[model samples]
Target: MKGRLVALVGPEQVELHEYDLPEIPPGAALLKVRRANVCGSDLHIWHFLSVAFRDIVMGHEFVAEVAELGEGLTTDSAGQPLKVGDRVAAVYYHTCLKCAACGRGDFSMCSNAVASMGAPPTSPPHFTGAFATHYFLSPGQFFYKVPDEVSDAAVAGANCGLAQMMFSLDKVGVRRGTNVVIQGAGGLGLYAAAVANRSGANVIVVEREPVRIAAARLFGAHHIVDMSELTTVEERTQRILDLTKGIGADAIIEVTGRSEAFAEAIEYARVGASIASVGNLNVGEKFELKFAPAWITRKQLRIVGVLRYDPWYLRDAIQFLADNGDRFPFDALTDRVFTMDEVIEALELSESRIVSRAAIIPV
Candidate 1:
């Protein structure tokens, strides 16, 4: 059998390639791509802005159906019965339990997290990215069967964006009655709002885009700080304070992918509060720090930089969708869809922000 994949050959360039599928190794599986989303990190990789990700597969967030199961594979990581054709979502990265970080129980920080994903598409078992028609699940990779109720549109992002937000919020202690401020109303921010709202926290989203502002409310934001109206750093800070009853946010989440948003998150955080820095992946001369070290020390803030989440969180994300999929418009998050041939268009639209979320159907 043959599978197709999208390969990044250079900055802002991609090519579609096809190769014979390799035999599924023991404890591994092969999945046929169903739905994939162009996540923010995809944009970064597309632009060659992400370190260690150049000339590789171009996607990570997706849901797939089991096309073939390797020998000795019978159940998912959660012990659920698995079979060919079962819908599943796998952690895009590897979690080598032998790694130092995994030995310390920090699976998310595994030293070889990208061992498989970092492989170039030209390698055997060439279907490594979600943008492709198939994905090869390496041995010991964590995957969960998707509930029958969750649409592919709703569950495609479970692996990356939604799962990461759930983990990030948990890391920062977002809970009932907490004033949680979300920076940016993009996919990550919207997911954060929905998670915080379901936890009974006061979800406050900060954004300038009208479409995203409306989407934020639908995703359960209790209040929104309109950047268009606030117009200044001081003004936005006062608004955040007002929304938090003069205490500032008990938890702040930064997902704007802008350096200024990181500095702005400090202003929105209350004393002793925690901030989850999930965006702003870039580093170097362009993304210089805009905030002062004194503020973090004086306020005693907890700033956590979250990358890909713990593998099991993908299971929790699927469960979250099963429990609350009807409560929020998860299907609507992807405003546009493109076919395998239109993958470039999908990337461009997502990069331009013309489509908040773009889905790729690679069948």
Candidate 2:
């Protein structure tokens, strides 16, 4: 069978190419890709900031339908209970069950963990990524069942962006009446704001883009600050403090990854505030801690780094979206949809900030 896949051939080139499907192995299931969402990490791979195995298929966030099942994988009979024709989202990574981190439910930190795509396969094979027409699934990795009410786009977003945000929210203890400052008004930023709002927090969104600032308000931002009009970081920080009634924000979620934004987050953080850094750390960016000594001693602030989420969070995220779908208006976040043939153009548009969340319909 022929499958269409996005390939990162070099630093400046990403193309959709046709390739032969690999044979299904025992204990694995074949899935037809339905919808794949373009993510920030995919852009990093396009720019060579994150390395991709040469000529490898290049998607990690997607939902698929099971087309075939290999021997030893009986439908609802084997230890793995997925049936053919089931709509599911791939877990994309696996860790050694016996590892210390795995025991603590920290698969991403496991010494023996594997990414489903990109990395070369390891013994007993772990980390299978989903960015192609079809993917192979292994036992012990999670494959979630999508509800009939949820659309393909919702599933795709829940699998990555929403899931990551939910995990970060849990990490930072977002709760009723919590004050949150979200840096950047892009896809992830907007989603973070929506999630924070659903968690009953008053959200303040700081963005440089005017268009995104307007968009942020629609996405549940109680306060919007366009940094372009502000002359100094203190001015911006003051705006956040004013919105929070001089306490500053209880938590700041930095999604821009710019050094200046990181500094601004620290400046605006409340005493005992938590800062969750979820953005990419680009090259040549240095965050200088000029007020660290005073701020650290006075505030007792906590700074946390968020990688991808735990597999279990996917279910929680999906449920949150389902319950709060009406309030969130997640459909508005999706700015464009493209077929597999237009993957490169969709990616370029996303990188240029022309759209919010671009969905790739593989079918």
RMSD (Cα, Å) for all candidates, in order, is 1.2, 3.3
Q: What do the candidate models score in CA lDDT, each in turn? A: 0.91, 0.74
Tens digits of per-residue lDDT for model 2 on 36-98? 888887777777776434444677788888888778766431224667787777666665578
Report the Cα lDDT for residue 158, model 1: 92
Overall local distance difference test of candidate 1: 0.91
In model 2, pairs of residues that clash are 114-127, 115-127, 116-127, 116-128, 116-129, 117-129
Model 2: how large is the Cα RMSD against the reference? 3.3
Error of 2 at 217 (Å): 2.1
Cα deviation in Å at residue 86, candidate 1? 0.4
- Model 1: per-residue lDDT, tens digit, 1-363? 788889999999999999898789999999999988998888888888877888788899999999999999999999999999999999999999998999998989999998888898888878888899999999899999998999999999999999999999999999999999999998899999999999999999999999999999999999999999999999999998888889999999999888888888998889999999988787863755667899999999999999989988999999999999889999989889999889999988878878878999997
Off by over 4 Å in 1: 285-291
